[model samples]
Target: MPEIRNFCIIAHIDHGKSTLADRLLERTGAITEREMQEQILDDMDLERERGITIKSHAIKMDYERPNGEKVIFNLIDTPGHVDFAYEVSRALKACEGALLVVDAAQGVEAQTISTLYQAIDQDLEIVPVINKIDLPGADIEGVSQQIVDLIGCDHKDILQVSGKTGDGVDLLLEAVYELIPGPGREKDKPLKALIFDSIFNTYRGSIVYVRVMEGTLHKGEGIRFMATDKEYDAEEIGYLKLEKMKTDKLEAGEVGYVIGSVKSLQDARVGDTLTTTKNPAKEPIPGYQEVKPMVFSGIYPTDSDDFEDLRSALEKLQLNDASLSYQPETSKALGFGFRAGFLGLLHMEIVQERLDREFDIDIITTVPNVEYEVHKMEKSEVVKKIVDNPSEMPDPGKVEQVYEPYIKASIITPSEYIGPIMNLCQERRGNYINQLHMQSNRVEITYELPMAEVVFDFYDRLKSSTRGYASLDYEFLEYRKGDLVRLDILLNGDPVDALSSITHRDKAYDLGRKLCGKLKELIPQQQFEVAIQAAIGSRVIARDTIRAMRKDVTAKCYGGDISRKRKLLEKQKEGKKRMKNVGSVEVPQEAFLAVLSMDDD
Candidate 1:
């Protein structure tokens, strides 16, 4: 245990966390030249294609020091996006130390500060590292000072390295071995292990990734999950390398995987305690907080027959991503579906894409919204209800007050772009908190913004307005009273439950008008005119019409008398009115997607 070092890499997005990880893996001889690749820890094709890390990856490395001492380093590379902050928190809990990598050019951004605070809360030893020093714009001295102010570490204690060129990585490794202490726990104690992560395997049942906090786990041992109280035989036990390396036993402070007869991820949840059935620990590990999803949207199978298949797919996915929460729901427009909750909009998009590519399920997703607290009068007594879907909200007349979720958002950007960023925030109805000027010309601005306003295209707009120089990190603050209302979209005079959204009263009229215009463009023209109306209760706020495909009944009587043509036109008008009454408009999938991007401009 003295030679074992377990640590994770935490950083802001695109700050060279994965690149730095690759250099360390190469330096430690974990992967050979033939297998070398960029962002090697990001194995998912979606992650590579998007140049981002989604899931946290754990790997073991064997490094030999100059003094002939061998060290075992368990490195977990985590995603840098704010949407995956839960992943970072889980990774931090399993390690004894962390490498807080900051970009030399970008310095410390919003996510950097947010993740650093998480690591600090975990009481992990933080080693500051400045990455991408090879860039011509690299501000090593300025960033080093920023690190000093942020972490309170000495200026010389910070390590400077270029992840792209593999410079100064060897020294960084030395810091990990010397500065970061090894896991300190007794092996003789009763068995106690923390399941940090788990994944579902088709043939193997469930593969659980565990960090042994106490005692030892051997191959073929009878194990049990304390939370679930389910027992299974440990069929296989091994250390996590580039691949699973089978081992006879795992000692205290070791990180590895265990294959068992557990049927699904639900049986072996992440953050659950694992112990031997015979000598179970007296108590489970503390500090396990259930993930609360921030954004809610309905996911329906494009084909109704695939409903059961979609459920099974979501179960498998939940095993891997515990942050995803869902429950069965039925919609009049979309039919049977699950209203799924996600960490953010990107997380929702990724889940949808994974369902399509990995599970081959065609799904329709509704407009995303945040959970709202509705205080309504029931029989002269006020009752509070949590409503995620706008359709689930009670009648406006009975509701006394509605509170929307708010977030404390922190944005870090260069001083030059602060005006545009602030204006953008103000346009979203943000309440200014405070601002602080950090080292160099960079500034950190804080604001209290409603989560509903940030859910749609806020991140994309922020990036474009700042020219990709700004980084944003936010957390749920509290629910605040807001003059909110449910905006309903009507297709041919029928309210589509799937198209209803809870929005602030101030923005409802403008949003309704925009939604109606967008739907008019995407909804195909029918034989009869299609009226797209946005409404609140019985009052229509905005309306648009898609002209019907005309048949020109008068064309056949071109040379007829004026009265004959008028008679033909009147008959055609009656036919159109009758068709409009019976015709049910089929809203294409594109129109549902258009609702999500209505505020892009």
Candidate 2:
């Protein structure tokens, strides 16, 4: 147990976390020269294609010190994006220490500070490491001072390493062996392992990734999940290296994978406790909080006959991604579907793409929105209801008040970009808080803004305006009362529930106008004019028209009397009116996607 060092790497996005992990693996001889690659832990093709890590990956490493002391290291690599903060939190729970990596040239940024606070809250030992020292603009001294101020550690304790060149990684590994404490061993106690993550395997059922806290788990033993109370025989037990290395048993203070006959992920939930059926633990592990999704959208099959297939695909996907939440729903225009909730827009996009590529299912996603709390008067009683879909909102006459979620956002950037960043925030209805000047020429500013405002394109705009120099991190603050209304979009004369949204009253008119204009350009022209209208209740606030396609019906009457031309034109107008009444507009998929990028106009 003393020789077992369990730790994870945490940092902001693109701060060499994965590269550092590769260097550490190479230094420890975990992977050979033939298997070396960039972002070796990010095995997903989507992750490598986008140059980002969306999931947390764990692997085991073995190393021997210069003094002939052998040690076992369990390393977990985590994502740095704010959307995956929950993943970082889950990874922290299974480790005793963390390697907080900061970019030497970029200094300390917003996500760095955000993840640092999470690590501190977990009471994990913090080891500061400055990465990317090989860069020409590397400022080791400036970044070291920033780390000292952030973690309050001595100057000599900070290690400088370049993940690209593998410099100082050996020393960093030594520090991990010396600084990070080992997990507590209780071999004699009852079996109690915490399931940090799990994935569904078609051949082996559910493969559970766990950190054993007490006793030993042997192959072919009867195990039970404490939360679900479901018992299954452990088919195989092994350590998680580059691949699953089979072992007869897993001891306490070790992290590994357990293959059981558990058929569903719900039976092996993340944060659930695992124990032997004969001698179970007295209580389950603590500090497991349920994840609350911040964004909501409806997902439907392109062909209504594939509804059942879509449900099964989502269920399989959810087995791998525990953060996704969904329930059955129906829309007037989109037909039967599920209302899905996600961590953020990026999370939603990844799930959508996975459903298409992995499951081979065609899907249509509605406009994304946030959950709202609606307090309405029902038979002289004030009842509060949670409404994620705009069409589910109660009538205006029965409403008392509506509350929207807000967030506390922190941004870190160079001093020169402060003005532009502040102006951008102000445009999003942000309330200024306070600012702090750091050691370098960087500033950290805080703001209180509605989560709805930041959900759509805020991060993209921030990156473009600051030329990718700004970093942002935000957390849910509270739900506050606001003058909010449901904005409905009508095509021809019928409302399209899939395009409806709930927004603040002040921005509704402008947003509606922009949406109508975008839809006008995206929606194709029909045989009759298609009237696109945005309305709040019965009052139409914005409108746009797509003219009908004419076939030159009066061309034969050009050499005839004026009355004949008039008669032919009248006949054409009447035919259009009849077509407009019976013909339903076929809204192209692009129209639904246009609502997502309305801010670009």
Candidate 3:
């Protein structure tokens, strides 16, 4: 049997993971010159534009060794955002080894360290590739030292290659073939294949990506999900010779696609196992970890009629990514907003971007939200309330405690920006972890902070302080009891209905006051003056005044410009039509975004 090698490229955001995959595909002749697309591994338009791999994409290529031996290589690429780290982990589990791409200029980033530790835990052989060697500021030696100090890897084995220039890429390939051993096959073992990632195909149904570990899987083979025990006859079992190109069968130790009698996407659950009943492997593949969404928000359309379309779009997205959990929810005030669950804030943003850009839906997104715990003093119990609004927290005084998620963060920036970052962290109630210095004049500072504290504005604040030179990454550390309260904002002296949420008391004070001030700015002067008050229950926090409009007269029309007078009336009607009437006040999209804007406060 021919030897098969399966590996994944893991890197921090913008660390050249996809770029290296591009050159590897080119050198392997898996893609013809004309077939090449920049970052082909990033299949989605959003992925291409964002310059991040949002989904786990795979491509097969052929490489000829120095001894003229042709080998088949299957490579998987994954997103670098912490939100989709679960997706990345699934991709890593499917591979026997990995290519750890670290930017020579950036050195060891938080994500780099995080993913490297995951790779180590998987016990997969890692080939550290210091990419972007062609860049002017690239420091191969310095980054190699980081690999040693942080990842505990040997400095000599670290391969320095430019994924862009294709310099020294061949050495990295050799290391893959030699050090990363070919996947082993147990011929006598039962059929056990892991579904690392899968997608819906119009013609073929749910095409489960199967990497055969034991026995061979043929076309029309009967397989069942080991976890769900849902069995189906495999209609078309094939290996990826190249994307969309399929062969007849996937032999043991090879990665391929299984597109047969799949009727629904629910059948092809990622991280599930597919095995033959007669000869199933004693144990399923052992590397998969469940990916739970970490961030959430509602997605609603402008036109009430488009509600169904929005729901359908979400369904299709969930068909491919089961990790994205959402349930249909309706509000008399807001109409409809999906209680969307995400792996992280970035994941939430990416989903919204895909919905707006790809689905072509005009959506009004609520603020990115985190899960909150609501305590009931009467019952002496706490209810986890991920979706918080004024209606749910009606009995605010009865609550004793609320727990929110917290994260361990690591920030990398210039030395000059350290003080500002430290101050910012301290202001957010951060417990300092440690700081390390690198040879290229960058510092790695660590902290433990409430996830809510770092949810928004922190990135912007960090960038503002550092002049856009800082990069931050964090992972959920744990959830703890916090001195939190629900801040509710009332516009026009009445609660703005939907603008109520929970936060730490200290955070709520500043955030509530700031939002009330912004709401005043957002609420245009109506026929009568409006009062914007931010509060927690009956206790008023901050107040802002929006005085009634001053002047409302039009310029006198000239004799020749009667048409101009008619045009003015038409413009007024159109503006009125666009403005939303809440009671007697008018609100626009800007008003909605203003309350939710990152820096509106």
How would you encode candidate 2's per-residue C-alpha lDDT over 212-251 as one tens digit per residue? 9899999999999998899999999999999899999999
Candidate 1 TM-score to native: 0.94
What's the lDDT for all of these models?
A: 0.90, 0.90, 0.76
Candidate 1 least-lDDT 10 residues: 592-601
Ranking by TM-score: 2, 1, 3
Q: After superposing candidate 3, which stretches have Cα over 4 Å from the reference?
A: 152-155, 287-289, 378-391, 550-583, 598-601
What's the count of clashing pairs in each model shown? 0, 0, 6
Candidate 2 has what TM-score? 0.95
Task: Put down candidate 1 lDDT per residue, 412-497, tens digits, no spaces.
Answer: 99999999999999988899999999988889999999999999789999999999989899998999999999899998889999
- C-alpha RMSD by candidate, in order: 2.2, 2.1, 6.2
**Model 1: residues >4 Å from true position, as ranges?**
303-312, 558-561
TM per prediction = 0.94, 0.95, 0.89
Which residue pairs come into collision in candidate 3? 190-279, 235-260, 293-342, 293-343, 294-342, 294-343
